[model samples]
Target: MKTDKPRVAIQGIRASFHEEAAFRYFGENIETIECNSFKQTFEALKNKEADYVVMAIENSIAGSILPNYSLMMGYSYPVVGEVYVPIQLHLMALPGVRFDDVKYVTSHPIAIRQCIDFFDEYPHLKIVESNDTAACAKRIRDEQLTDTVAIANTLAAQLYGLDVLERRIESNKLNFTRFLILTTHENNKKKGPANKASLCFQVNNEVGALAKVLNVFCHENVNMSKIQSMPVLGKRNEYNFYVDIEWEEAKQFDNSIRQILKYTHNFNILGEYQQYIEDDSPKPQTKPDNTKRYITVKKIE
Candidate 1:
């Protein structure tokens, strides 16, 4: 079936996790614009080359990607929506290659860190870092490296014609990454109903200045989901506070934002969009058969 699809810019190759998140958010029909870096993903949107961008903001196992927060502030791109993708790292290699034959393991630094416990069991294997997980798998397949293994998602193994030597190799089985759907200012002007918002501000350099701002949100009955402080560049004793707040009543959020502005400096509303709610229970895991040409992974509940 052919249909017009929105072009979504993602910070990795086609089979990377970012692309998976984009598929989950925009449906499988959407077109993807691959960008080498997160900054480049935003550049695609800025240059009108892509309609939207899917960028990872944080990982459950690795904490937040602080550089992305800076990019959000620098570009001022509006976050229209969000999605959470499970980070399931798999050990993949050339067809018929066994785990015993693997000599080197390579993947993105973040992916390698998550699977540190799994790799600890194999001390003989040399660990290497790559720019992207899917790219690592592609390299192994293209070069037919029998001694090399790639730590990546199941999609990578399927797309690159590699076999999964080990599944769910990440140290934390519950790992998941949250991604933000970003669009240009004009495109986001009529954004859908928003129950959550991300705000960035700096408090006065005085005692109780920050607390006063928190008190305002409390008074308005708004729920603060996250609060992170980043040091201000070229300024001493100053920091930028990034906050995520959720609200049931729109007026409460509006009232709180109005009150907060009076208590902070350089206040900026980074985004206002629907919050991504994760499923409560874990989903059943299914092992892929070797004969299957393409393996499809179910979304984590």
Candidate 2:
């Protein structure tokens, strides 16, 4: 139950994974607040209702939590840190709830997709969407509803005192959730091994505009970890790029960022921090499929 004693607003209830990630980052007893939407989380931070907001920006199975990406840009907040929690999705329920007795499965979209194998097996069971995977777990715990279950992490079960009837229900084994720690208070303090930086920018609608913008990094031999595009409102054929860079914050880090800034009309450097979980996990034997480029970007719709 250790904590930094800061009021934290997360997107869901106590048992939600956002709370879990927040606890991992800030420790327990964070003077928690719950926000119904990502916007509300930022609002809480702005209005000083909460000192920070912890949220998921991407997943191993789902790419670019698009709304969150835009939200980060819309808000005047800074990404202070990050965490990658291993998503050990579980089929959890109330006591005496047998696997055979379940008729409805509730969770977030990514949770439902991760446990596709289980849903496929229980063809008669309906997959219901909830605001969050752990929120569903918390709901189940509060109501003690029969014949209903949730897919969430072990943290949720531990928080709500629910029985994990089945563990590791994700269709894939290498499930992981990447979380972002956001604060408006200029929290420059970060734990060691910080290597990545998230940035966003919009370029003038011109031929080869993006290429020119990206060349800034290529010239510096800085690696581009990820790049995603979102359309600009009322502007067809124009989009903004959200970029994640494997940045090396040496004496030259700031200079490199400055050079990139000259080429773009609008830009934002969200955060420069270490990969919390990946830095701690065992080195992968091979390049994982989770990092592979996809033809169609899957996002929260």
Q: Which stretches of candidate 1 lie over 4 Å from their true place?
A: 1-3, 189-191, 279-301
Candidate 2 error regions (>4 Å): 1-4, 186-194, 275-301
Which 10-residue window of candidate 2 scores lowest in summed lDDT? 291-300
lDDT of 1 by residue, 1-301 (tens): 2236777888778589998898778766666777778888888788777888899988887888899999999999888888999898999999899888889999999999998898898999999999999999989988999999999998788778888988998989999999999999787753467899888999999989999999998999999998999999899999999999999989999999888888999999988998887657764333323442222222222
- The global C-alpha lDDT for each of the candidates, from Candidate 1 onward, is 0.85, 0.76
Model 1 steric clash total: 0
**Global Cα RMSD, each model:** 5.9, 8.5
Q: Ten-residue segment with the worst summed lDDT in candidate 1?
A: 292-301
**Which candidate tops lDDT?**
1
